[model samples]
Target chain A: MCIVCGCGHAEAGTGEPEHDHGHKHHHSHGSRLDFGGGPAGVSLPGLDQARILRIETDVLAENDLIAAHNRAYLSEHGILALNLVSSPGSGKTTLLVRTIADLKDRFPIAVIEGDQQTSLDTERICATGVPALQINTGKGCHLDAHMIDHALTTLAPGQGSLLLIENVGNLVCPAGFDLGEAHKVVILSVTEGEDKPLKYPNMFAAADLMILTKTDLLPYLRFDADRCIDYARRVNPKIGILRLSSETGHGLAAWYDWIEARRIPVSQQED
Target chain B: MHEMSLTNGILRILEDQARTRNFSRVRTVWLEIGTLSHVDPEAIRFCFESTSKGTIAEEACLVILEPAGQAWCLDCSQSVTVTRRGDPCPICGGFMLHVTGGEELRITELEVE
Candidate 1:
């Protein structure tokens, strides 16, 4: 397991091998485990005593740095990168499949699919005749910026192309990690509780746009659309909302139009 | 849990600091986690204990400081303290509460030898 994030796959870091923690440092219940109990709190002869360092550093600084690099690279290439976030069973893959099929003629597209242990979504995207890559995070629930950094090399999306990253089907963990995308598009289905916005406020707040998927079933389900929007707005007043059903092809034009409007201008494209 | 990842992040930071500052081990870590950061302090404690093993921070003391959540209510035009998200303005009872603080997940200080 990657010790940095406890994700099943080990991406690169200090490259230290795993160690067994069980040792002869047994202490009483009330006693402290003092590894530097020498005079002046010193453990080594050459080093000084223990001193406090005011680091004031963000815990996720490493990830954020890598994400910033990714943002720079994508910006240099003028790629419209979107990180798609949602829970499992929200029809994210289905929506992607439909979106790709409809927009293939308009733009060059590629996909990077993130899942704990599956290549199924990548296969579905490839079926649409567009290049796609799958990242199996193993036990990792969310995709980090470092992983995205490596995938960018293999995917090598062309300039001005649309890059869609289907993050692991999770709402809570993905919110904290920035994947260097232009926007975080969260997909919520009508089948789930409308109060999801209230329940997972971080995801709702982090998202730039909330796509209500499976809207065709709204007639059968008692999902309150207004209440859901109200809750989402309560969390993020500026978040954009779009409702669409990939099955019936309803409200898809607006979704496409949204993408078109956000596309980077060709004149600003770089090699 | 996301806390596992966060614990690892803390470890990485410690190791990086150790390399630059020529420290061998970490004695204690003081983390400032805000109430609105979506990070659970208890979960972080559990993960830290389990993941810090066999590392420089093994058996190290973790001090968590939870700062109160603060938000600006547009309706009342004043800042108010909130415990969590979706909270209405304490004074005006409106939904225009914009969070301004308590989302910090930072390692403020560390004791190393």
Candidate 2:
């Protein structure tokens, strides 16, 4: 057995013995298994609990570290981290503009607008007089943690600032990444249809809140609001949804109220 | 099409690996992309070809492993493979499912020369 943990032999690098060298290798899945073992007599099938635990240690441990750093950074700076995810033309920017205007009294707001190229969204956010930082991803489809780190540093958002990170307008690529956001807010427009939650399941699954924007235009569209919620609930039952319109000022109050209430404890957050 | 950025991230990792491990070139990159992760494998491969040029991962063969979405069935207390995300459990057809896997994207391994 590998000396690292009492499991099977460590494959190539770590010194674990390979007892099942030329034996019948049959797994539950009919695939050939190369249990990473060394010269020592180690059998993977009869692995000890310690080695099994070590073997299952995360491969993507870096992301977790970065995410933790991000969380601490956001909390320490008292930045209200909201990661906005959605498909293109999902009205994420429009909602942010209206949200900034609606809740400017309660909290100072800053916007981090990410796009492949173009300062259009930043221009829009700045028109509202809130401090805005435009991050031109320059062909990137999603905003990773490092990008957010750069944006936050550049923007230099002060204490008690609500920072909305309007992530690259792609539904899929941004779902898995954690940008140390207080919450992931996914925008699903009415024109996009209700089945979007089911189709782009991961985004819905990761999101803490679901915003069905463009409700005023729903009269002209065939978006099933109930079905969307049902699908969203199927993927993530805990997701809270707000059906709102940025244009006509519908459901904007509750959206503002929700964020104002879900404030992160500045003292409790790590420095 | 954040594949370009992802390719950049992969290149960054390979460059770090090369510097630390004394490797000059990467022969193969095994990536485990979730079916529900929303990343297009074709787009990543296309970007990888151009992005890998001159990098340590130059000429690396990209292999993608699609892990089936697994959901824990509340009724049966067993995990079932799901073809699509937000679908009912395959074994018991229960609406109450706790997703346990297939919503992650990671560059699993790299074979170097």
Candidate 3:
């Protein structure tokens, strides 16, 4: 028994009679591979008889559990939560500002802005005459499901309303975490590299839609829209693509249409 | 990096297992990471080594098993091996490949006492 925790074998690494041997052995018999072969020990000293315990589990299980709770809660309340992800300066805030401006009267809209620092994005979102909350992650790269759960309790968006979560401006880390949104929408501006989808295939693969922002600058820049679309499709064949210029109000109608089409009603009927 | 989060998750699992299974310490961790999972094994190792300190899994050894990514080719009607996400089918050389396997990042086993 462990002297420290009183669980097993006197803490495995302390100076016990079990520490006198050079227990290092690597042998495989049949299909089982044995290590040390006596008893499984801790970090040092005795590796003679270590026990192998099979526990097949995902590392993100905890996060995924919380995300599932968020999903069920949102679905029950007839809420449409969209997770917006993009690299820095991809015009997510600008596009959101425009989108909220146009759709605020049509339905109730709330925003949850995530950033490492500063409430500037949340401030911009609130300026549109809509309720918005800012979650500063401090050192976190992306917002997790637990944070979203807290934000939901604090925000308390109306039933059958739209909730937009603008994730920290990152193309990489956010792809791995599921925030229990209806869909993950990745925004890429024309000013950036057209091959971003290929460069960050994980994000493209995880996203349900790819919004090509800053289309008004297409004439001034040499960004190839067709190639960009091809690359995005290469990663995710079913990803919906949209081209919009928030500055010129070019393709906002289609975007708003997409949102309205997916918004779940309080008594939504299933097909 | 998200590897940090993944490592923290591994630690959480280890601690939880220790409590339930009545293990005092963890000696080694066996993880199966897919080639196309976008999780670098080296980065995971580094993150685990750093974060596992002062925890029940402190000084625990990490053993990573990388499985090859496999994709199904719609044009060829065959499954082919892929190393990256956007790689075309090796047999048909077409881009109509859908990933079918090898996106797992799971802990398969543990050595504890």
What is the lDDT of every predicted structure here?
A: 0.85, 0.74, 0.84
- Grade the docking of candidate 1: acceptable
Clashes of each: 0, 7, 10
Runs of candidate 2 exceeding 4 Å displacement: A1-64, A265-271
Model 1's lDDT to the true fold? 0.85
Model 3 stretches with alpha carbons more than 4 Å out: A1-50, A266-271
lDDT of 1 by residue, A1-271 (tens): 2211112223333333332211111111223333224332222234343476657789988999999999999999989999999999999999999999999998899999999997999999999999999999999999999999999999999888999999999989999999899999999999999999999999998999999999999999999999999999888877999999999999999999999999998987875
User: Which pairs, if any, clash in model 3?
Assistant: A1-A10, A2-A8, A2-A10, A38-A48, A38-A49, A39-A48, A39-A49, A39-A50, A40-A49, A40-A50
Give each prediction's DockQ, rounded to 2 decimals: 0.30, 0.36, 0.34
Per-residue lDDT over B1-113 for candidate 2, one digit per residue giving the tens place of the 0 to 100 score: 66776677777777777787666877766576666666778888899999888877777778776665667788889877776767787777667887776655666445565
RMSD of each: 10.7, 7.0, 8.7
Alpha-carbon RMSD, candidate 2 = 7.0
Question: lDDT by residue for model 3 over B1-113, one digit each (tens)?
Answer: 88888888899899899999899899888787877886889999999989998998899988786766778899999888888988778997788888976778888668787
Per-residue alpha-carbon lDDT of model 2 for A1-271, expressed as tens digits?
2222222332443432332221222221113344335322223444331221111223245556687888888777777889999999988888888888878787788888889999999999999999999888785677777777777778888786888999998878788678889899999899886888888887888899999999999889878899889999898877999999899998988898889777766665445
TM-score between model 2 and native? 0.79
